[model samples]
Target: MNINDHNPLPTYHAADNRYQEMKYRRTGKSGLMLPEISLGLWHNFGHNADFTLGRKIIRRAFDLGISHFDLANNYGPPYGSAEENFGRIFKKDLLPYRDELIISSKAGWDMWPGPYGNWGSKKYLIASCDQSLKRMGLDYVDIFYHHRPDPETPLEETMGALDQLVRQGKALYVGISQYSAEETARAYSILKEMGTPLLIHQPRYSMLDRWVEGGLLDVLEEKGIGSIAFSPLEQGLLTNKYLKGIPEDSRAAKDGRYLKPDQISGDKIQMIKKLNDIAISRGQTLAQMAIAWLLKDQRITSVLVGVSRPEQLDDNVASIKNSQFSDSEITEIKTIIGA
Candidate 1:
């Protein structure tokens, strides 16, 4: 059979064999469900990047049963370009099957220069969602999030903007990212009082980063808010691509904004080697092991990962096939990371 030849154009149906390997999990106590692994356009789906390749990655992810796609208004190096590129993909490929997907976009970072363009102020959050919807060619998003905490803005006001988004039918659910335990609790109560439950929380978590362990995880458990961890591989530090040195095609080499050369310290490299050995014992790569480790916490609803190529998506999806970690393996990982 010709790879591109088919009588009936494929729709987003579960019967598609490529989707059989994907797994879906419920988000906390909510009725919403998400794939175990969700794709994000945080790095590679910008306007300057190959748009054709971005479309391929999005379509391939859908074919492989990745239903959730996470984006933010300021994701691209040249901010807003990622959403514009995804807008093209939406019109070309995934528009017909929009109902079968959980598409989310966020605001709350430095999207533009003016006061109304940044932070968690009602003006920024509300306006950003409108711009994001326009850019993505969507009527409404499945989820809308505050990309990060805005220290200057009142938490009540920010939550009010999110609540208003739901009331206006612009977003089905709302979430917060990179918020501390205290801030999350405060926002959770405000949303709850407004009759809009906080659906999920996105945080930077990985083998090397445990900022959420002490309090944030407990708060989410108490409030029944689901979590989807971003940078689960620590911005590719957990992957073997950095085991020797930064490869030419690696994110560190391509984009130094997030993953810089200074981040690959001697101690981090040693930890990666030790963790890689442990992953080898489990018959997994360090990337796979890192993902599985994140999923071990049932409160974690999904692992939000970014991929530069199709092969990376394939490898990341394969991690779900072995999500389990034995008690001993967990303890060993803790020892290695010194958690």
Candidate 2:
């Protein structure tokens, strides 16, 4: 018997009606189904954060029907702290519900030191997946991704590493994040030849950043591969938080690691205010309307969102309630965005 087995904690019973409000979308042409709004641990769940608060946010996400949790090898400020904290939380509160969850991790960015630590070489990819599995305390991740494209590494080598992971039972599916449209097509062809089809593509998409609209969304639609939009709120700029300048506790004010203060210019603030008015007309927050805008496309499988508090999940999940937009509303939004 395990020594820690004697130390029992309070039981966590998930809500029985958790699936009633939220909708699940099929991932690409695959059998997997993910929630419309998946929880992402890119921020707020790290060694620097309070463990109890992180736990509460995670529990609340599940209670609201968020069954998928996204993570990366270098998410935390110190790197790998998010995965470590998530591993502990999983063992404590979510262990029993392992089969009900879809956990994903990536290994393409800078993780450790020296040559072998970063990039998308076969050796690096394999070793990084092993390290991530050990850290998350899981035998297999549902979807393991190459976090970014490596300029130095050949696509064949990187795609091969992902295929090998699936064959080894280390990852059920393989995905590529932030790959260009041509690169995504090449990856799909390569993975198809390898007999392990690429499952999904994660791209940074929002009203403010419309790079994906240029060609990435078209590629995903033609290839029949599911796409998840990260940074769907443009790192909180699409929300009402920046209307009166950056808040003292905002990501921009604190670290600006992702969303810098300078990025929120006067013009951006004016645009946000305009969007907020439209959101109010729809009976939704600006953040909700921003998320709903992404979900307007059928090609988008899910929108990955990060929340600092549990209450935020309730608001984010409620975006699905009014995902459909009127023709006039769309036209007005495009005019405001100058698209």
Q: Estimate each model's TM-score.
A: 0.93, 0.96
33-118 in candidate 2: lDDT tens per residue?
99999999998877778777788888899989999999998988678888888998898899999999999999988899999999
Query: Using TM-score as the measure, which candidate wins?
Result: 2
C-alpha RMSD values across all candidates = 3.9, 3.1
Off by over 4 Å in 1: 1-15, 253-255
Candidate 2 residues lying further than 4 Å off, grouped into runs, are 1-9
How many steric overlaps does candidate 1 have? 0
- When summed lDDT is taken over every stretch of 10 residues in candidate 1, the lowest stretch is 1-10
